[model samples]
Target: MTNQATTLPESFRELEPYVADWALPTRQERYDMRLSKTIDELGEFYDAIAPRAEEAIGYLNELDLNDLPDDATRLLHLLYSMVLVSYPVNVFKQPRIPDSGAAFFDTVAEPSV
Candidate 1:
């Protein structure tokens, strides 16, 4: 496949620093380390990219959900995941840890096609 980075939307540019590698994993892989970021790091990342989130979502909303290209599909999924996770859902509450222990953890699974 061509470098997916070249095809990403401008709204997604801010996320490049954190998610440059957007690799889709194989069935054998349960999680992708590339998506890992500490809570504070994620907060910073969100702060940087939050401005574009709406535009990204608007672009996604304009797409024909039934017939999106692989890249567009991936972007839509990534954007959707970001919106969902950003909401303060008590059901998905994270555990508290010491500042020293605040480091990126590998847990995000690759988006399923």
Candidate 2:
């Protein structure tokens, strides 16, 4: 167990360093966070999380998405943020949308579960 209160499952403690920055609740927030970081920064997060994604999904698969514990909920958000940043890290090699000036996405309704 970690000395600080655990924000993620014990097995995923290695990801704690990213929780403060990457664990976002809404899709738009995750997207905005992606736009805020440099490609290198996004790549760093991608490299760290990609290898553990399947494991994280497997662990989360056992839980109820609708009523996850606080730790699991945060983990879910981290996954969401990872997805948001992936395009920039893997394809675009840029933070903002390409060839779309002032274009932005506003999430009207976040997923229920």
Candidate 3:
């Protein structure tokens, strides 16, 4: 898919009226988070999933989420703001493919269709 950014229409974590029932970080708090400052850490997180994210939009060719659970996919989509971060693609997609087998650790299945 095109390199479009990802976003939720209405977060279950941010539901109004019942918003308090779900614990979510304030928008300012989320923006201020240091872990979100750079693309590297976010990419690192995505890199960890690069290998098995096929079937999902994060698959190398397109933004498919056929691999992870819906909850996990939604969480990652929110954090990275895209289907796949470039970190893994830049660092591990080629020169490190062999050792990068570790990328598949803790792989989770996508929610059933």
| Residue-wise C-alpha lDDT for candidate 1, range 19-77, written one tens digit per residue | 44332233222123213544454455446556777777788778887787765665655
Candidate 1 ranges with C-alpha deviation above 4 Å: 1-5, 20-36, 87-113
- Give residue 61's lDDT in candidate 2 (0 to 100): 96
**Candidate 1: C-alpha lDDT:** 0.49
Give the CA lDDT, 0 to 100, for residue 33 in model 2: 77
Write the residue-wise lDDT of candidate 3 on 78-103 in tens digits: 44332333433465442223465546
Candidate 2 residues lying further than 4 Å off, grouped into runs, are 1-5
| RMSD vs true structure, all candidates | 7.3, 1.7, 15.7
Off by over 4 Å in 3: 1-35, 38-40, 58-84, 87-113
Model 1, TM vs. native: 0.50
The residue pairs that clash in candidate 1, if any, are none
Clashes of 3: 10
Clashing residue pairs for model 2: none
